[model samples]
Target: MKLTTTSRIAGSAALCASLALAGCGGGSGSGSQAQGQIVDGGTFTMALNADPGNLDPQSSAASALFTISQLAYDTLLGVDPAGGQIRSQLADRWSAAGTTVKLTLRKGVTCADGTPLTARTVADNLTYVGDPKNKSPFLGTFLPAGARAAADDATGEVTLTLAAPAPFVLNGLASLPIVCAGGMSDRTSLAKTTAGTGPYKLTEAVPGDHYTYAIRDGYTWGPNGASTATPGMPDTVTIRIVENPATAANLLLSGELNAAQVTGPDAQRLDKAGLFAARTAAVLGEQWYNQAEGRATRDPAVRLALTQALDLGQLRTVLGAGQATPPTTLAAIEPLACPGGTLASALPAHDPAAATEALKKIAGKTLTFAYSTAGGSAATATAELAVQQWKAAGITVTPKPQSGEAINQTLFGTGDWDIAWAQVNVNSPDQIVPFLSGPGVPDGTNFAGIRNSEYDAAVKRASAMDGTAGCATWLEAEAALVKAADVVPFANQQIATYGAKARFETPGQLIPTSIRMLDR
Candidate 1:
């Protein structure tokens, strides 16, 4: 794989929009491994924090969609966990120069419908998403915006002509869940059915309950050419929806669940239980204040005072249960492409007295605040603490805790919020452009209606360079956002995917192909 833009983007584009708070950024692995003999054909059940309502993988940047997409979709390329290098998946050979990309499809690839995977199908997937009218959320996140595609079936090649230069092009392509020709034809069926040339095929779908998938035979095109026919590979994958972290932890200890992401207070006991884990460091605690018209947070003073009122150090300790670390960047997932920035110096010092004085502008007005309930009990306590801090600063803010789905609607749909805990977790700073500096809701993904001229100008200069060559400028761009109080990133932690009778991998989302059922 060869990826270059204006010399490779100076920083990796946290390209994919992940709505999940935990599974979004940074990369690493820890815990014991290979505890027992490999066991084949057993069911691998993992707990999903929320049900991905829309099954269309290309439609949402929500973490739920990103997680489930891993099971039934295949991307053009992938990123290596240890080295941050590009790896092949569906595409055998691929390269990018400036704004043009070329991909060579591997032979003998087949979709879930038993149809051969062709170059046309690959090109069509890009075309469909590249068209802004289609409104695919992946238009710029995973696939470059306004990119055009051409297919040469005779040679199994798909050529992409991007409208703009992108540094993380190859890495971003690794995250775009490519659709099969059949699914592309009947797009709405994707809402409940499976489509793609992935290692697994969806067998059953019950919203808010469990999603079941069966491993596909003769599939050998996972990241780094991983295969599904290997021994110890699960015959079935079950993603069960369990909202409570403690309940999910209980299920894991009871031998009912093979895997579950247990955060909150429950993680402490699970760690002592000695289960094998695939850990990922991520920016799990973040605050975004809406700066849209008529909102109190729109005022730079209000945004700064709100950020100053709370002691981020204490909140990080509380939110992460005293095990969290200081966050480094806005990009939250693991194996970060350009993890060379700090959110500290840019943040305002905790000053309650100054906050109380600054917030006098909106004396009696109550700000509508929302937090994602997916963070479990710790998140509830964190939001409550924030409310108390704000109140003490002479700020009247209403705290509203919402489920993962409700949080998405509140942020992207109605925009009826003053402050929220939602995040746009990706691996690159360039990928954050849509959420930070574009048109607001009803027009673009910039849900908060942010208007940071410094961030906009800095990102332009940074995005012009390739690879980490422009690292300083990219860091400058991130600093602009934080220094202006447009976003408040507080805690980073080792978000672990605990395994009971199983072992897996998590670069960002849990790798479906890396799961191995164990005979304990």
Candidate 2:
């Protein structure tokens, strides 16, 4: 099947120059806040290109904004930075035996709205996410079926019961910022407020623009590993929307901004400037294709050809220095990374000749490509390189630059594209569920619309088992996915974490809300 080429054809104008010219400055400034807030000294300004999909933790997938919300909102538990274990938050301590988990809530904690933070609030929040009616994309992956919460308000105790053993429970719970019962009663309303027992409170959010937060002085319940939740760091934390990396770099250099996401050559330039430090984390870069599009992408041959054609090193070069690491497996190339299997074998070598022959088999088919978020020159350049290789195999690819909303709609939304470029957040290997399972349309993250009973069975078997056995099951499942040509995973990219002059420890996972700034 032929891939649609958009990157090369769409560059009629210098894409970077046009984006910069369109008022895409580094970051914008909002008004200062009133005195005596959680951040009481200076305002911590963070510039992001896009606003989060929603404040409703359950409804939205992982994004730059979702990471930040954790600081403003608190979850029952959070991942510990020092040892990578689950740590207490509103719930002081927690233990699990089999599928049953008990939590001891911290007393004297209250929500921003004045309601006491109790076991009932924790119960309600857990139940709300598990309820299918809510249609939360994260529930099934993070929470097990038959999960229920029982709370004793008087004792400030809550117990969680799951259908089966879940090792990644804490990682999932960390994303669930506790909400009030009143807010939980109306899911739609709760999506916009900060009722959790977190350190910061969401003061305002202007969708598609920026969000504002102030420290909750009454908040003493925090992540167990946090040194201290001092209420005097920055009185206000404002997240400004700056879509252009060049503009963001400039602003950062000028000291108009505190932190910004620099990409492509811009990121390299920043490292050389000696003004800021940098950190990097591994993440997945998914080569998404639409299964419902009725194109060759649904055919195994086409998917295999594309996966084989991908030279990860080439892609990394396009990403520039220290932006990404080459990945051999679809999972994060870390401790839990699964081994080789059918999927790995089915992927063709990075030989253009073989790709051309495979394309010739499906000649006359055109593939449509969609990309989420604004691609810096590097991503665009990588796409261009991919197009050149695919064209050699006789494929005609049409690449389209669409908003993250539009891209999500096409894949998980309406299933309209033949192929697309997308990024998935992963802290552990289990996060690769949507793409490996069958019958179900992989909760919102599954862009390929993969469905295979074998693949599903393998993933389940692996999940119940431990260590290499489980990894083997997932390996087989990944092979099945590759063999079926469901989704093509090229590179599991790394996220660039730029350290600003403001002193603070960066979390292992790039969750913005969990970070606490320390004065130098």
Candidate 3:
């Protein structure tokens, strides 16, 4: 049920001619460059499937648009846009001693409104995210402990004291995008105005319609990973929200868009036009089975059966061109993506007969496999397909279409689900323990409600180990989780970037550490 609508549209003859007429130059390598150097002044037209639900940084749950917002806002730290490795942004230098970490902030930094970026502001941001009074959902994945944050205004440094040793603390800090404390007074308004201190500044944002960001004029405050602000390619970048594939394709054909995300059959149409180029990125997709509720899926056997019945090949075909990949491991398509060995290699193949037998064991219990399709029609269709496939295995899965907010509310809020599908972020094994371990890693994203002591122990060991040894230990933990049916990771989603053939190069996901515009 984990659904995504973004797809790459590349290599179109008509697109190139259109770009030429639009004065975007007549080059055929539009989808290859990273630093899109179209010069400044003209508005960069872009598109998104939906609007981001929140922008509080602490309460924001829309994963799709957070990165986009990150461009306009500055996090305590940033990651390479292409590589996704931790890099400095606001913090100048950082060190860890046991569970306490100290961060020294770079001086003379200013917010978009010209307020000095102070250590107190840094502490406030963390304190806000960590505060129970705030009721921030982001707290679950971050700030998990008897953690304390304090800033030394004189030294321009902030120190975090953790209750226990948390190795991935930097990763968590990297996620807290800083916004002007003054502008954030109205939390609702923050969503529309992505106020922060980064290369780009928000100019306009109309929910579900479009958003605009302009380069911060005369701005020069970047960490080691970023180049000095060189006036972002399109002086003004406009994101047009289009959810339908055909309409997005049609818009591209009419030259209304410089970049568009195309998927399914639409990719074929653009490719046949011979004017668009495509680049594929991978995302881990999971068929989240809610085990907390009193449902037939609470039995691990039923969950295992459903996992085994999934036909990765069929899912890919249904997913259409450049939409998916059959994941071999928890880290599937990541560069550091570990295969988890042959033991991990022995993933259950699609076996309807075995699945049918497994379902018979729990014949009396009715199963409800629930999923939400609020983001777009693609998710709704994907959920329906899962329902049909599961029915073939003698399991009755009722596919439901709720708004993304409603579905997330039920799954993460009330836990009122027999089964729901989602995609888990397993970028590192260090992140696995909280997802699989005890009574939910407090404020953790493991919404499946799994609590395994042995798995927790294994994850701790893996997190401490260095190099390949750590990966092996994580592999063990992954196996334990899979065997326990804690989570059923079915496939890895492919990140598709589409653009006009001669306009610019399309980088998959922009690395936060480095802000590189494609086809510059």
Quick one: best TM-score, which candidate?
Answer: 1
Q: For model 1, how does the per-residue alpha-carbon lDDT over 355-461 read when each residue is reduced to its tens digit?
A: 99999999989999977666777878888999999999998899887766666778778888998876566677666677788767766677788899999898788
Candidate 2 clash total? 17
Report lDDT (CA) for all predictions: 0.76, 0.55, 0.54
lDDT of 2 at 100: 79
Candidate 3 regions with alpha-carbon error over 4 angstroms:
1-37, 81-85, 140-144, 183-192, 223-232, 268-280, 320-323, 329-346, 361-366, 371-384, 402-406, 413-416, 432-444, 466-469, 501-520
lDDT of 1: 0.76
**Model 2, span 1-520: residue lDDT tens:** 0010110000100111110000000111111111112333567776665445567655644344344455556677765543456777777778877677888887787777788877887888788777766665555545654689889988888989888776556555654556766667676775666656666678888877778888666556665534224534566777776666677778877766666655568776766765443233333244655655456877666777776666756765675444554444554322333434334354445766677777786788777777643446666777777777777668888777665444545655666678776654344445456434532343444446666677778777876774345766667776666556565554433334443434333342234333434342
Candidate 2 Cα errors over 4 Å, as ranges:
1-40, 225-232, 321-323, 328-347, 438-445, 466-472, 479-485, 492-494, 508-520
Residue lDDT tens for model 3, 399-450? 6555433454555567666766554343344433434443431354455677
* Ten-residue stretch with the least lDDT total in model 1: 2-11
Off by over 4 Å in 1: 1-34
Positional deviation of residue 319's Cα in model 2 after best superposition, in angstroms: 2.6
Q: Is candidate 1 or candidate 2 better by lDDT?
A: 1
Model 2 is weakest, by summed lDDT over 10 consecutive residues, at 1-10
Q: Give TM-scores for every candidate, taking all chains together and pairing residue i with residue i.
A: 0.94, 0.83, 0.80
Worst 10 residues of 3 by lDDT: 16-25
Candidate 3 global lDDT: 0.54
